[model samples]
Target: MKCLSMLAAALAVAGSVQAAEVQVAVAANFTAPMRKIAPMFEADTGHKAVLSFGSTGKFYTQIVNGAPFGVLLAADDATPARLEREGLGGSRFTYAVGRLVLWSRQAELVDAHGAVLKAGKFERLAVADPKLAPYGAAAYETLTKLGLLDTLRPKLVQGENIGQAYQFAATGNAQLGFVALSQVQADGKLKEGSAWIVPLSMHTPIRQDAILLAKAKDNKAAAAFMQYLRIDKVRAVMRAYGYEH
Candidate 1:
């Protein structure tokens, strides 16, 4: 594949620069793209990104509780902004804009218009904990905008993070879920099942932000990783996973 070839080529470009690792706290919804980017990042920059993924809120709590994360890739802009305001972070920037989707592992369970929600055909619907994951909040906002929140509240199942919400649908624990589009799509196409790409108008934009944590202010690898996010190849990888700038 062209992408694999690119990654291999990038990895072959060994540098004379010293190598170091940076601990990164990443948002759960960004798991797929971040996994691909990490290897490419090491190959290109001679630095390894040690990644840990979870809900933005939980990661924030961990960061506040003395977690040694050098950088944070958050699911929402607010978390990074809050860190920067509190002097816990620096060099904050918007890395990606996430899209929400109503998805199901079954080929036709989810309709293009997402009418199935109002039809009440499914017994369960999964969403990440809105208090933790921005995608979950967007899901709730979508339901409220559609006037279906109260009607569907009884059937809602909550996950600690977007990854778990996606798992609930993938494993059939729920008939459907509100999840990040990146989880079910790749190379500009759906990897499996069916989904309704939730309209942006239904909720506020999910502006995923990245920041350099104060703890790693002097860490070269952390600084390099933040700068590396602006490269074309890196942006290209993000696009393949359904993220928008």
Candidate 2:
């Protein structure tokens, strides 16, 4: 009888040490990379990552309202900084730096140097909502720097987020769009579209930041996943998705 009792206690302790599942709120631009990384993280640490992808602005509002998120991978550093300032997040760090690109599914529509923007050949151009997405704001900045914002205003079609903006161009709703470099690139090459990699000097850096939410301060799984992101193998996956860590 004592042996059985001891076995029971051991089983309970082992169960208590089992890994946990973490809820991660991710920016849309990082969706692809996170999808690839989540499985690897789980395999390496026995922790499952549950991901939710959307605009950083929207995720901020949700987190402020207690969305039960363990961590946030934001599209911009400012959002994470704001969360830290509000005491909603703890221990923030930069995870990746994003690059913007002007892309089109149609062949020969977008030029290598982005001269196509000056020509104004398209009837409509897609861009994310500048107020809600950092990539959109960067797109605006790029157009303004090129003296094309005013010229292109009439033809602009605003998407709620960069993903939708890319969709607009992909599905033929708009001829071209400003999107994340990862969206159109695979294995260090263009996937199937023409793209003009935007110059870094044209706009401010899109330095993406990650933070552990206050709600997850005591969650071991959350801490493990955050640490996983900093590992060299995980960073390689991020780079494969066109992010600079």
Candidate 3:
């Protein structure tokens, strides 16, 4: 029965080669890129990444309270650092530097220099809630730097997060909005309408970071996905979405 024994051993080896699924919590600003990359990761490694998107701040709260996420891709570096300090995460690194942009679905609405802020041409200008979204904080900083915060306060409509802020602008609920450049860019160019890329000097850098949660420290699938993020092909996908490594 040597052949039967060998067949049993081969089946055991095949079972050992099968990959596991990992759960990930992603920042709202990164949803698009992650959506594109997750399947690629699964195809390459035989591992599955189940992703959930939302504000990093909310994710932080959930993680602290024992959410089952194995990894976190935050919109800003601070949240990931905090998780590490709190002993909830390990092996953190800056994955991308995010850029903020002033976008309008309508053509000729937002000028290249973003001077429309001073002209008061729009009835409602949307921004993500500064308390929840890092991009929202950057938007607030940009407005303050441009001396428009006080003047534009009355005209502001705040979204729950950057994704929602983008929706407000896209659906014409708000005339224009401050959103992540990735939301408006595709294939290394603006997909539609008018946009003013905010100068990085106007606000603090949005250094997005990723971390392996302590809960998944020993998880092979979680570790594989984290390594996949650093691969050149994945970085290229991130670049197409306007992220800088």
Candidate 4:
């Protein structure tokens, strides 16, 4: 009992001494899971995660322009690799594998087989800008695989990122939109809308990667946060939001 007490005291002192804040730029698709994770991370490690969520492409640009981000959780693996090659990033690894979905506000608007897309019943079909979001690229690839890109091109509406695309569908600005599965799913079920979870064969895998930025090389909090992401608790949260880790 006395040895256990001494070990507990030592751990408490170490945590207090190492506690610090990490600035993380997270992809928009990871918002829900990250929100839940940030608090848990702080509680567990005595380090605070200051998160900013947005499109991975935009965040990459920002990082290049000297954005004060200590870490990046990108929506695609390529961005981190680019940063690594440019010497702007340190350690990197795949944190999650994302899934795409065609979602609608109406519960029955999207069929399980995703045949509604061919029905042409909707006037507007929203998608993120493929140049700025990986999910958008996946959506386009899916459309192409189904031989529907040219047919649906006329009705396409673009958003700056997946979050905006989801908003467009959620607010009825677009009848339906291509979004991250994590955005509309929790507890292994859809939240409020109808969706067709796009098959993996339709596009390249969306391997989301996390990187320790060059500016954060000496930041212990940043390194700890990156390591924390691999814990079982964090993986559970990612799974709950439909992310494969």
Candidate 5:
């Protein structure tokens, strides 16, 4: 309820901004929410948000290597702060928080509420590279807390980003993977799959941040889009996809 109310207020503010188009480099975990909000953002702002999705580490490398992105919505705060500190970004803001979930494509194979994990039937698990992706870190923390990290370590297959990690599970390349909850959510309900909502006890908070890249600070469209993202409606859309307010 608190999240919803706050989101409403934010969206209201976004609606008041004039429309323009901007280029956004986003983390793969934000795929679902960005898809949900893209049309609305374009319609309301009269600006199109051209997006490039990838791992935060990769994006950071690209930005440093001169990838042309006006704004960056990263999976964690540190990366964006680095951009600001390096003078690559004019301003940085934390727009939302994220949550991680364990998911499998096979619904019968998962018991989100049960100790299905204790059965240990799966041969492989997939996760983004913990050293590179925040979701992967959460997965590692969750397993460690459950006393399963040692047992699961050998079964782990790493992806460069959360999207690829989900692909590993969805394509059955891995029995399951650590993923963003939104991937399994559609229209406010969980999809046909077994999942475990790892307790927040497992990891550090995913404080995702948005930064105004030096290339975009003066771009009215990009700045507008960033402001639009701060609106409650946008945040609400993000929450619906399993992000924190």
Candidate 6:
């Protein structure tokens, strides 16, 4: 029947569409903005995104072990560069740069005018585990550059990743922590907290990059996501969430 033939053709097209989903391993720092951008991507391209968020280091380790991710959004370029060098990723591109902040759950604890370090009022501090999270490396560099590393080191609790570092402060387990700016964006506003945006000059640039994995080299959906990252609307959304293009 003609009607049956038309229905069969429609079903075939649907199957092809379903097969185009891209699985993305995203750094935890980018999770918030990625969430906001993925729907726009889907709307524009008719492809779905499957995302997993964790420390970039951990994600790199997993990818090396065959984690089946089609793309990687890393907090630093080194991971993507490594993937490219290893033939695991076909191409590399800078997506956005991350900004670090000193954040505390308590208003009086962090010092609005940025005198907390000078006052040394807090007995506990938290940072991401430097071995795991890129933000931790930036935090260490910042403190070291300020000549505060030795003094602050004694008061530190290390979280496994930036998310965990934020948790440490949110749960009051640590008085303060270093976190990504994206984590604080809620309802188009920064979260209620006392925060000092760490000067970028204090540390190495957090040059985040995204890559299309080898397994996804031929995947249209995966490539589409990369192009989506460069779109002006997506950049606008990323900027609103404190990402630097």
Of 5 and 6, which scores higher on lDDT? 6
Per-prediction backbone clash count: 0, 0, 0, 0, 10, 0
TM-score of candidate 6 versus the correct structure, residues matched by position: 0.89
Query: What do the candidate models score in CA lDDT, each in turn?
Result: 0.92, 0.89, 0.90, 0.91, 0.82, 0.83
Q: List where candidate 1 sits over 4 angstroms from the true fold.
A: 1-15
Model 5's alpha-carbon lDDT is 0.82
Lowest lDDT sum, 10 consecutive residues, model 4, at 3-12
Model 5 bad stretches (over 4 Å): 1-20
Q: Would you list the clashing residue pairs of candidate 1?
A: none
Number of the top-ranking candidate, with lDDT as the measure:
1
lDDT of 2: 0.89
Better of 1 and 4 by lDDT: 1
lDDT of 3 by residue, 1-245 (tens): 45544543443343359888889999999998999998877766677899999999899999999999999999999999999999999899998999999999999999999989999989999999999899999999999999999999999999988999999999999999999999999889999989999999999999999999999998878887777777677788999989998
Please give, for residues 158-241, the per-residue lDDT of candidate 2 as tens digits: 998888898899999999999999898867878887889999999999999999999999887888777777776677788887
Rate residue 98 of model 6 by lDDT.
87
Error of 5 at 44 (Å): 0.8
lDDT tens per residue, model 1, 1-245: 47655543544353225778899999999999999999988877688999999999999999999999999999999999999999999899999999999999999988999999999999899999999999999999999999999999999999999999999999999999999999999999999999999999999999999999999998978987887787777888889888999
> Which residue window of length 10 is worst by lDDT in model 6?
4-13
Candidate 5 lDDT over 1-245, as tens digits, reads 57655654554466557555677998999988898777887666566889889999989999999988999999999999988889899667888888788888887787755366667899889999998898988888888888988987888999989999999999999988889887787666777678887777678888999999998767877877777777767777877777776
Report the lDDT tens digits of candidate 4 across residue range 1-245. Answer: 45544543443355578798889999999999999999977777688889999999999999999999999999999999999999999789999999999999998999998999999899999999999899999999999999999999999999999999999999999999999999999988899979999999999999999999999998878987887787766788999889996
Which ranking of candidates, highest lDDT first? 1, 4, 3, 2, 6, 5
